[model samples]
Each structure stands twice: as C-alpha cells, then as structure tokens.
Target: MNKQQTPITFWGIGAQKAGTSWLYYNLSKTPGFSIPPVKEFHYFDRDTKYPSPNILSITKTRDRVFSITYLIKAVRAILSSVFRGNFHNIGFFLKWYFSNYNDNWYLSIFNRYSGSKGEITPSYSMLSKDDISKMYNLSPDAKLIFMLRNPVDRAWSHFRHIKKRIKGFKLEDVQEKEIIEFIQSEGQELRSNYLRTIENFTSVFPKEQILVGFYDAIIDSPEQLLEEVVQFITIDEQSNKEFNQKSDEEDLPTKEIVNKSIELDCPPEILNLLKEKYHDMILELANQYGGYFNKWYLETYGKNSVNENNRLQNTIHLN
Candidate 1:
C-alpha cells in the first residue's frame, strides 16, 4: 500500500507496566511487522505543543537588528528550499517532534513496510472520549489490545517504577506506614480501572475489535498469548519469535523481590478496598466477556479478590 493508504492494523492500548515494553520488542522482531523506533509516541493522548510558530511570532516584536536577522533566516530558508529541497534548517529538532504528532507524519514512519504496522503506547488507554473517537475514525479496522494486571498489583508496580525515577529514592528508607499512602496518591487510578477503560473503548469499537488479556496469563503463557494476538490481527504467523520474556529484561529485579521489599505488601486494607471497588466491574467482565478475566482474577487473587466474600461485600466505594 502507498503511504497515504497504509493503515495501522493493531494497537497496544496499555495498562501501564503491564508488559507493553515486552510486547513492543517482540512484535518489532516478528517477521512482516513494523513497529516505530520509539515505543510511546504520545500522539493521540498527549497534546502536540510545538513552539516553533510561537517563537517566530514572539520574535517579530524584537528590535531592528533581530528583525533583520529573522528576515535573513527566512530568505536563507527559501533559498535552501529551492536549491537543496530543505525548507527548514537541519538544527530545528522541534520540526521532527512536530512531525511525530501529525497523522501524515505517523503514517510516514511505516511507509517502507507493507505488512502489519502497529505501535505500543500504554497511555493511549487514558485518551479522552473525543480523541478515542478520532482514533477510531482514523483506523476503524485496527485491532486494539489491552493487557490488565490485578489493580492492586499494577498500582504497586507503577509506584515502584516511579520510585526508581525519583532522585535519592529508596524503598527501605521510606516509613512503613507511609508507603501505602504514597502509592495511593501517586498510582494511576484511571489505568487501574480496566472495566471503565474497556467499556469506553468498546463503546466506540465493537467487542470483537478489542482484546483484553491479563498480565498474569501473558507472563505465564506468552507464546500462546502471542499466537492468539497474531491470529486476531490476521498477521502472518511467526514461527521464530520468543515472547515468554522481554528480550531486554535480564538483570532486572524479580517481581518477588520487589514485592518483598514493600512493607505490608501494599497494605491489606488498601488491597481489600481496591478489590471491593473493582469487584462489580470484574463481575461484569466475567458475565459479558467470558471466564478468561474472571478466572484469572480468582486464580491470581484467591477468595479476597471478589465481593462475594462477606468482609468485602460491604466495602464498595466509588472514586
């Protein structure tokens, strides 16, 4: 297909920290698949705030000498356009950034590939309704995939990730009582609300167009998960791809180690609260989408996961 006609065949709508990086790496390696060089383009979910035009506009009010310099640059740009087919200077890094957020610019990234093209931007799950509709309008045929983790587990992992990024941060240095409080405030609650997020997406796209898989299952059976994904996207089956672990995941802290480091293991109270909050949502998913998610929840979290338990039945609280 030509550049203009090319369509993205798949999308990894992320629950952040839910194996999106691993998925991106594996899919990029698969035969006949083209993934962007960068993982998170943030084009759809983030505002494209390139300041080039604003800078030029503000520069218009500068003194005579500066005005002359601007005029000279404009003239030079014109000459460069005519002689070298370059309308802008090579030093304009924002030009490249500006292009990244545009539809044509995104499409051009996959121009050389005729096979399945996709991107993994986990934050796309947080897109507003209008933006999601815009995405659907652009690529109605795209198969969307969302990988979910137990909300409590996902929230804890997210907190740990943020913890690592902050300067001088240490899990052991933090007070035991404050760990749950900090994670609650810092965690991405919107991401943890899988049912709502999926509902919003499914409202815009048909049920068959969206695939929701759990992180536990993906980690446990990645090859089988990927095989199902390949079938869903109708891409040519890949025989040589390894999906059980991230290609670059070596030397990373193990999940057990990470969990052990957290005191109280995310506070049983908060964990129970999260379970109660998401109980109805999970039940709806179980009833409507089948046992994949429900069964996974039961198997992963045990009896404490659902509201059917007497203690959790009265713990429902809305955001």
Candidate 2:
C-alpha cells in the first residue's frame, strides 16, 4: 500500500459504450503509459460499503456473473475457508468490493510500473459534483477524457446492454412498450443526461483539463483521435503503435454478449420522444464543440432549422 506521489495523468470518464474499452485497451499497450490489469477501477464511482449483490439497475451492476472461472474461484475460497475454519470467502468478497477506499490500495494497482497512469471507468459519468470534487482532491491535475455519442444512440446501446444482462431474457422477445417505458424511466435516462455530467466535471476541473471526444469521430478516424489523445496526455508519440483493438466493434457492457448482431429494437416513437427532449441540448453541444453531433443530426434526422426553432418556440409558449 504505497501512496502515489504523482497525480493521475489521464482518465477516461465516460459516456459508456462510446469507445472507452478500445481506448483503454490501446492505452494499456502503448509505451510510457501504465494501465492497471483491470480497466475499470470503480474507485471514484463507489464507496467503502459492501456492494449489494441484488443490484436492480443493470448499468450499476458489474458485468461479470457466475462464470466458470468465477465458480472455480468461489469453490476454492469456500473449500479453503472450511479447512482453515475461517470466513476467508466473505473477506475476499469484501476486499474486492471495497478495494478503492484504501488510497494506498488504489495507488498500488499502478505502482508496479514507472510511467503515466490512469483508469477508464464509464460509470464515473454518473458521479455527483461532490464525488467529482473528491476525485479532484485525489488527483487534482488528472486529465479527463469524455467520449460522447448521439444521446439517443447512446441510450439505446445502454438499454440493449442492460437487456442482454438479464438472465433468461432474449432481447428479441422484449416488448416495444416495455422497453420504451424503461428507456423513459429516470433510472435509465440519467445515464444519458450528458449535459449535467459534463458540467459536474468541468465545474471542478478546468475546461482545458477536460477533453471531450465524439464516438462517430473515433469510428471515422481512429488514427487521428489516437494521435490527438497521445499528444494531449503527453505520452511519447515516438512509440506510436497502430490501434490494434477493433475500434469498429461495439463495446458491450456485459461480456455475455459479444457482438452488435441484435437489431436495435427501439421504436421510432421512442426515438422521436428522445429527440424532442434532447434536440436543443444536442444542438447546443454540437455548436459548442463543433464535433460530430451536428453532422450526425443532419445525417440521421435531416436539416430542419425552422422546425427546430418552432419546436423551441412552442416550448417557450407552453412554459
């Protein structure tokens, strides 16, 4: 348990499913960067309490379940506990769940190497301003990277991710009405309230310390994005290696699902509702960042300035 003398150099604070896994995988392989064996530290996102095994929110739960490897480990721990006449298995679970509270424990994860270190935990986006402030206290100079996608698309992906995780649930069998209700529900919608999350991080961290990227751009030109990230983090560009990770592949939240073969089951009505809800925010973000959001809106929904303005005007009138 050694305390880190240096602040964390980089972070991928996220809009999940937006190329974070690809970023983490590539950064881990890159030179002059020290990435821990586990990609998501869950340090800033969690507290020092026993994590509930009966977590209802799919997004809040860890992706892994009782896998063959996990089963073997559990059996070994149980057998060891019985022989030792002690509850070692319970201790193991506690340590794994609450490992982040120990500052030295978190630091030790990256202490094996001498280089710039960081973590890529998508759930950190849901953190409160107070939590982010605490994170700043831990690493005041940490550079934050946020990758965003079209909110509708991001939410849809998130829904699909949750759907895939439910045991005995086939996504195709899910009803459109039920899915739409779930999407519109507060629990799910909060994850895509990007405006609030971004503000929370930027309000504490200087705008220059935060780097916002787009998922479409990452797909369209990963090499450019890779180089930009490298330069931003001050990683040695001389050791630049090609991004071998399949950036094109969907970064599913759960390991149970491997591919994006499942056709998105979101109803057009639901999409329209989301667009109506988020269009103004989306437009503002696109305008502010000059990134892919505006272009994506144009391509997906077509150009309609008059209609959009009218929609805003109607909202004003209604208010």
Candidate 3:
C-alpha cells in the first residue's frame, strides 16, 4: 500500500514497567515489522505543550521549558529523530513537536516502512476521554496491546524504579513509610488499575480489538508471547503488498533483556499493604481476566504471601 493509504496496524497502550521495552526491542529486530525509531511517540497522549502553541492543537504548547525534565525530553526527541539517518523523518519530527500534527503527519512517521507499522506509548493508558476519542477517530480499526502485572508486584516494581533512579540507590536505604505513601499516591493507583484501562478503551473500541497480555507470560513464555503478537498484527494486515513472510524454523528468535528491574524483593509488610489497598481492584481484575492472573491472585493474596506480609507488618507495627 502507498504511504497515504497505509493504516496504523496496532498500538501498545501500556501499564508502565510491564515489558513494553522488551516488546519494542523484539519487534524492532524482527523482520517485516516497521516501527518508528523512537518507541514512545506520545502522539495520542503527549503534553503537546510548547512555548508557542499551534492553533489546531490548541493549548498543546505547554509552559514546560521551565522544567529540566521537559527540556531534556524535548531535546532528546529532536536529536534522536535527526540522528536516525532518515532525512525525511526530520521534517516529520519538526512538525510533530512544533506544529499541529494531523493524522497524515503521524502516518508519515511509520508509512516509510513497507511492512506492518505501529508505536508503543505506555502513558496512553491514562489518556483522557477526549484524547482517546480523538484516537478512535484516526484509526478505529487499529489493534491495541495492553500488558498487565500483579497489582502489588507492579506497584512495588514501579516504586523501586523511582528510587533506583537516584544515585547509589539501595533497597536498605529506602524507608518503609516512603514506600507506603508512594503506593497510595494517585499516580501509582492509576497505573495499576487494569480495570480502568479496560473500561477506558472499551468506551471507544470493541473488546476483540484489545489484547490484554500478562507479565507472567513474558517471564514464562517470551517467544510464544512475541509470536502471538506478530500473528495478531499479521491477521489484520495480511493484504499489505510489501509485508514480509515469516522466517524459517532455524531462524528461531532469541529473547533480549530490556530494562530488567532490580531484584529488590518486596517486603512482606509492604506487600500486605499493597494487597490490602488494592484488594478490590485486584479481585475485579482476576474476575474479569483469568489465566495466570487468577493463579497470581490465589498464590499471592490467598496463599503464603498473606502470611509472609502480615508477619513482616507485625514486626514493624507491634499493633
């Protein structure tokens, strides 16, 4: 298909820290798949803010120049796009960051690839209803990929990630109270809410279009999970003229470690707190989406994890 006619194949709306990087890396290396060099385009859910905003994307230009992190990200995106060795994409990147990014401009980023194309932006899970509606208007038929982790496990992992970013970050140096407050915060609450993600997307798209995967599968059957995703895309885009055929049997794919988290085991007390706080959310998740998630609930909250967490809390609280 030509560039203008090419439709977006899929989107990875994610629960952050849930194997998105690994998925992106595998897809980038795999033949026949054409993804943008920059993994998180943040198109559907970016701040879209700059000092001087465009009229069409009204209020997109945020007053973010004052923040160091925003400046770093802005510079990084432009630099990555420039150094990608594709001259045409520079124009696309310029328009993406500076002007109103219409659907065609967004398509220009991936249409360069003859095979299947899409992007992964985990933050899109938290997109507002208006933004998600905008996404629907652009590519209603696009497949969505959402990966979930155990609520407590995912929250703890995300907390640890924040701490780990500091210089010489250590599990021992982190205080228990800090972890508790972090878990209770609105941000973490939103990230771990698989049900909200389900409800949000289903508001605009059908159930079959969304693929809810498990973090458990990533550890247990990485190759199978990757293949399943590839198959999912291929089924939709089979008619694309330039799509490449799957490789031979001997060319088996090898999994690469991408953004592996530090192995700081969750304290039982913290685990108990997480479980207690997110009990309903987790239970609802288990009820709605079974498989390893169900087993995870039984094995985690209902089994030894409960006793272990309570014991740790008893030592700390003495209540």
Candidate 4:
C-alpha cells in the first residue's frame, strides 16, 4: 500500500434534511473521491458497540484498555493488517478493536476505506466547541463545508420527518406542547445562533479552508455550485461531471403534511403565538441572507412577482 499522505474529509456539520443526504450521495459517486460506505458515522455522539464483523475479540486485556503505548502499537498493527487484507493477522484484528481510541483513529479508517478522499458525519454541525476543536486538532488541513437552508422550512421539514420515525412510540413524560416548544426552540436556535458555528470554526481555520453554500443556490443551480465544490476539493474533470449529473430531486413533505404536523405538535394558542413571534424574525433572517426565504418561496410555490394591481385584486376578493 502506498504511504498515506494528507486526506481530505468533508464535515457536514449540518442543518439536517437540508440536502445533506443528496450531497453525500452525489459526492460519493465521484470516481476518485471515497465517500464513506456509511454516510453518517456519528462517531463523536457516543461510542457504539463494535460489530462482530469488525471486532476480533471481547477479551479485556490490560493492553486493550489501559496502556497508552500498548494501545498505539496495537492500533498500528491492526490498521496494517486490515489495509493489507490480512484478516487472520492478530495485530490487524487488535487494531480494529481499538479504532475508537480517538478522532485520528476515525481518520485512519477513512484512509483505509478510500484511496483519494473521505468524509465524516454531517451531524458534526451539532458538535460542541471542544469537539470541533478536537476535530481541527486531529486533522488540521481537513476542509469543512456547511450547507444552510431557510430555517423555518428546514425545521418544519425536520420535525415532520422525525415525528414519523417515533409515530407509535409513546412519550408519556413529554407532552405535545413540550415537543413543539423543543422543535420551535431548536429551529430558532439554528437560524439565529448557528452562524456562530462558522465564526468558531473560522477562528481555528483560515477563511479559504471553510466554504459555506446556501441551500437556495444549490437548488437553483446545482451544477454551478457543485463545480465550485469540486474545485474546492480538487476533484478531476470526469469526477466533476459525474458529481454534477447525480443531482436527484429531494423528497419533501407536502404542505398538508406540514400543516398537519404543526397541528398535531402544537396547541392552537401556542401555535398562533409562535407564528406571530416568528414572522418578523423569519423575514429579517430572509433579508439578511440575501432574500433566501423569498427565493425559496418563489421556487417552491412558483409565484411570479406580484404587481400592485394583482395585490389590490386579491384584497378585494378577500373582502
């Protein structure tokens, strides 16, 4: 195996459901780029039990658990065996066992999985300050890309999506109001506060290393935006064409589903209050982000610019 040089990792650090899956799918298809087999590794959230396929043994040896020097040597051996395709090598098996030691171990896993480039969990957007710093420290040169969307729409879509997953799961401890409140709060936080994620990351890495793309731009002209992404990652021409062609229509909930979700998740009074509270804030955010909300609305609703006469006619019809 060729000695590994610096590897590029894409961190989704997300506005979930904001075209992240689509981005991952298309980028993974790029011939030279090695999108991880599992898109959302989510290693930072919590350590999961190792799969039998990957885990060599459960025997608790002091070497596996205690000694830092022993652990590093064991990891190096395991990595070598795995990469060499020598499954029977005990050292390789042992390295696989200790792969969860640090974020660097995860980066090594990416190197093994793909020859050219690798990306990690998009959920890194929700990481705390310390985690982000640790990620930077582990791979200082790793490029970061953040995908952002209209907060109201993104949040509503996310809520409906998550609610479907836990449809029959009872939550006796948490009331519907609380759930709605949680959703509303999270939505607002993403809109208002998540910009700080950029600030925090930029503090550690230079401006050029970090790229931010709006969801509206991606939807409007994916080819162009994807080309920019390809340039940033230094992907080849053939891979660029493949990545551009892989755009698929993202599945979104219908208006009826969104309304139904709001009804089911919020009390009428609270819903009305939230609508009133968020209307101005949403518009302000829209304006701040270069009318991102308006662009999204027009694209989604297919409304041409309304003239004064049309507005007057609509008012008369309402009366």
TM for every model, in the order presented, reads 0.66, 0.70, 0.77, 0.59
Better of 1 and 3 by lDDT: 3
- Give the alpha carbon lDDT tens digit for every residue of 182-242 in model 1: 5455226667777667768888888777876556655455655655665666644452233
Clashing pairs in 4: 13-125, 78-92
**Which tens-of-lDDT digit does each residue in 1-319 have in candidate 3?**
3324656878998888887888888787776777776787667764543111122343244543466875676677778767877666566556555544556677666656666679988777777667788877777777888877777788888877777678777878978888888888766777777777878888888777788766767777776677677766666455322223444434335356677676788888988888887777666655644455556667777732222222111001001
Tens-digit lDDT track for model 2 on 1-319?
1234654788888877777777787677655677765577677665533121222122321443434665565566656666777553445444443343456555555545556678888877877888799878777777888877788787778777776666666655767788778778764565677888877888898878777766765556665566567667764444333222333343322222223423456677777877787787777755554336556566556753322322110001000
Lowest summed lDDT window (length 10), candidate 4? 310-319
In order, the Cα lDDT scores of the candidates are: 0.59, 0.62, 0.68, 0.53
**Tens-digit per-residue lDDT, 1-319, candidate 4:** 1223555555666656566666676566554676654566565543223211222232345445686866786677667768878664553245445544454566566556553465645456655666677767666666677776655556655555556566564445457676567565643354334456666677676666676665655556555555566556654566555544554443222111111232234445544554554455444434444345445434433443322122111001000
Q: Each prediction's Cα RMSD?
A: 10.2, 9.5, 8.5, 10.9
Top TM-score prediction, candidate number: 3
Residue 23 error, candidate 1, Å:
0.8
Q: After superposition, how far is residue 166 of candidate 2 from its true place, in Å?
A: 5.8
Lowest lDDT sum, 10 consecutive residues, model 1, at 310-319
Clashes of 2: 0
